[model samples]
Target chain A: MTIVSYIFLIIGAMFFLLGGLGVLRMPDTFNRIQAGTKATTLGAFSIVIGVIFGSVENHLDWIPKLIIIIVFIAISSPIGSSTIAKATYRSKNIPDNLVQDDFKKRGENQ
Target chain B: MKYLITFITLLVVYLFLAGFVIEEVILGSFVSAVLTILLANRLNFKVDWHFPLKLIKFIFVYIPVFIWKLILANIDVARRVLSFKIPLNPGIVKVKTNLKGDLGKLTLANSITLTPGTLSIDVEDDCIYVHTIDVKKSSKDQNQKEISGPFEKILGGIFE
Candidate 1:
């Protein structure tokens, strides 16, 4: 169990690192946001869940709180990202090399 | 009926969040009941209420699979980020959805936003505009296979 928890934590950390890297490497705001949100959300989730497993041997009481956090993340994180994306669009923050602006096509400027 | 469901849901959330103490549960239920009665008309559920057994199935069955995909997505993004000069052809593509209810559309939109390489930008009618990290990867067929195909099946069952 300890080994498994260690693996989860390590992988979670790796994902978080990769997400930060992706943010730095991506060319534009939209791409950066995509990379940053998707990777970090999952990274945070994995890390928390990993910690739950790690705590199971001695700190079993913490498990429900961790699950609650995970559920909160699962519900809230995507909505948060989508709100950011919508804001970026409304602020004319579309990426320069973006192949198409379907919002423009759809005339959904709010 | 809708108000009752809303009250029950709020109570459950309250119990989960408040650590399931008897006092907390009772207080939360009273608070939830009042809130639900006050807000019930705003929910706009015109149809007669039915037991949401399929929705329970969706929560239990579909959510675990969605989480698995999310893990895969992060790994894929990490791989792409770590790779050298893998040309990212980012673009907005429209995907068709068959989900009937407002809740279904909202769930599908949120699902796509969190999944690999796709961010759901807007939904106009039955079409959803999604920004992809690699447009080449999210061709129409792939969109059906990857994005909507997974949840659409169970969501259809639940929301229908």
Candidate 2:
């Protein structure tokens, strides 16, 4: 692999590590989701881009797949996070420091 | 005419992504688009193609800014995680959205959810229910309001 590709791979590995750390160390579910979603997306993207560069012969094919993967990640990650957050909130697993719950109020009103 | 346009757009997108032959892409897109249009019509859904062109510029500008904010939030969360004291006060707060349409609501929800330590729980009428992982005692209101900035700009660009 070229120097640039190695750099990208290293960066990607760092991001993935941070994401795992976030999941382990973050206090709450919401924070963990954020760490996992954002870091993994960028980390995976960087690694894939590196792979694309390393495989110059199949660059065209891999590049499109990478784009597709990025798009899919962008569209689905937030939705998945939102779903998990909502479930956690409803299940009362969130920490007690929260103030100003409009969702609960709306539920009460309804 | 709308159906034809939708069909063509879908076909082009399919061909571009799948790298299929023009003929196969055209056939597949036509079939899917026709089915989608019929289903949409039956569901009384309207497709608004008159998207504000001015908002396109805003979208392009907002993307980098949003990504920057995401990175900053990630760092903040990482720091909090590494700290000795677990300073967490998670709560759901409702912020009123100024966005006017379905697209605006979706954009706002997605943006909020993308940020670290926050999640968009629900959207009802003009308000978005967001859950924050860390809610400081004195600055709860300020934090909630600050969270709206990214969504406001991006949704405003897309909807307004």
Candidate 3:
């Protein structure tokens, strides 16, 4: 593997590990979702890019597929995280020390 | 015209991702574009021909700020989780919004949910139902004001 590929692999691994740590260490469901989405998206993209770089055969094919993967991840991760966070919030699992909420006002306005 | 553009964009996106050859891709794109246009027209969704340039720009600007907030919240949450006491004072709060459009409302709601420690549960006409992780620091009502302040400004800049 080339130096760049190795670098990408290392970066990907670090991001994946950070995501795991965030999931384990975050105090609340919302925080965990934030960490999981951001870190995992970066991690997965990095790994895919690394693979594209390291591959000797059909490099073009891999690159396009990687691009597709990145695009899908970017679009979908936030939606999934938002859904989970909403569910958790409705379920009343949030931490007790929160300072402000804008959603409730939205409810009142309706 | 707006529906046509949206349809074309969607079709192109679909074909590009699907990785079809040029001819097949064009055929698929045309079919999907026509379908999208028909559906959108039938649904009575008004297509705003004049683009919200300011709103698009604001979204880009707000992204970095949102990321910074996420990182800070992550650290705070991590610390709390590691502590033996696990300091938490969860509560639900309502926040008022000034965004005038559906897109603006959605942007604000999604942004709030993306932030660590806050979840946007529901969105009413001009209000939002947010569940917060820490409620001991302030009253639920006060929390609503503080929580909505930045988002209101950001979305206001974008939508209004």
Candidate 4:
């Protein structure tokens, strides 16, 4: 149990580090936010799953809580990231290298 | 009927989240009922009458695909980050989907967001704006084939 959890923990930490690197390396807020959200969602979820398996199971309580955390994160993360993207676009902080702009048509229609 | 279903669903979720504690369960049950009523319309609460058989298929099939994609997504992102050159050609490209149901579209959106290089920006009816980091020259065809097409293919069987 410890070994499996540790492996997952290491993988999660690696993903988290990658996400941090992505945020630093990406040129714009949009790219940074996307990288951060994607990596962190998976990263944190793996860590939670790892913990669910690793910890001493005196009672079977932690499993459900951890599962709920994963479900909650899965449902909410994309929505949150999309919300941030919407706000960033609305504020007109367009990235210098932004190539296409299809989202504006809907905004204009509104 | 919908309210009852919503209440029960929320109650179950509440219990799961609270981890079977007596005090938490009691308090959460009341809160769940209240919240269920408060957010009923937003929830679009409905149980498909054909749920059982479809759900069995979803569990057996779709889950494996989703899990596979989840693992691949993390690995892909990690690779992108570790690569020496900052490989980015980010753009919000318009892509169209034929998926009709809310659940199918939502699933596709979440899947796209979770997958590497593609982030779902907006879903307007049938059109989705996807922000991708790296764009291949044949990106138009590639994005359709790789990103939205696979999920949409499987989801059609489930949702449609």
Interface RMSD of 4: 1.6
lDDT tens digits, residue span A15-99, model 2: 8888898788776577677777777766776787788777666556556666677668777878887888778878977565456
True contacts reproduced, candidate 3:
0.33
lDDT string for model 3 (A18-64, tens) is 77987887766665675676667667877887888887455554555
Better of 1 and 3 by DockQ: 1
DockQ for each of the predicted structures, in order?
0.64, 0.61, 0.31, 0.70
The segments of candidate 2 whose C-alpha lies over 4 angstroms from its true place after superposition are A51-57, A97-100, B20-49, B52-55, B84-86, B139-141
Superposition error at B42 for model 2 (Å) = 3.9
TM-score against native, each model: 0.84, 0.81, 0.67, 0.85
Which ranges in model 1 have alpha carbons more than 4 Å from their true place? A108-110, B33-52, B137-146
Descending-TM-score candidate ranking: 4, 1, 2, 3
Question: Candidate 3: deviation at residue B138, Å?
Answer: 3.7
Docking tier of model 3: it is acceptable
Each model's chain A TM-score: 0.91, 0.83, 0.88, 0.90
Please give the TM-score that candidate 4 achieves against the real structure. Answer: 0.85
| lDDT digits (tens) for residues A43-67 of candidate 4 | 8988887897687456466888777
Task: Quote the positional error of residue A15 for candidate 2 in Å.
Answer: 1.9
Over the stretch A1-110, how does candidate 1's per-residue lDDT look in tens digits? 88888888988888889889988998887788888888888888879978988999997767767888987887788888888887888898677777755667776443
DockQ, model 1, C-alpha based: 0.64
Which ten contiguous residues of candidate 4 chain A have the minimum total lDDT? A52-61
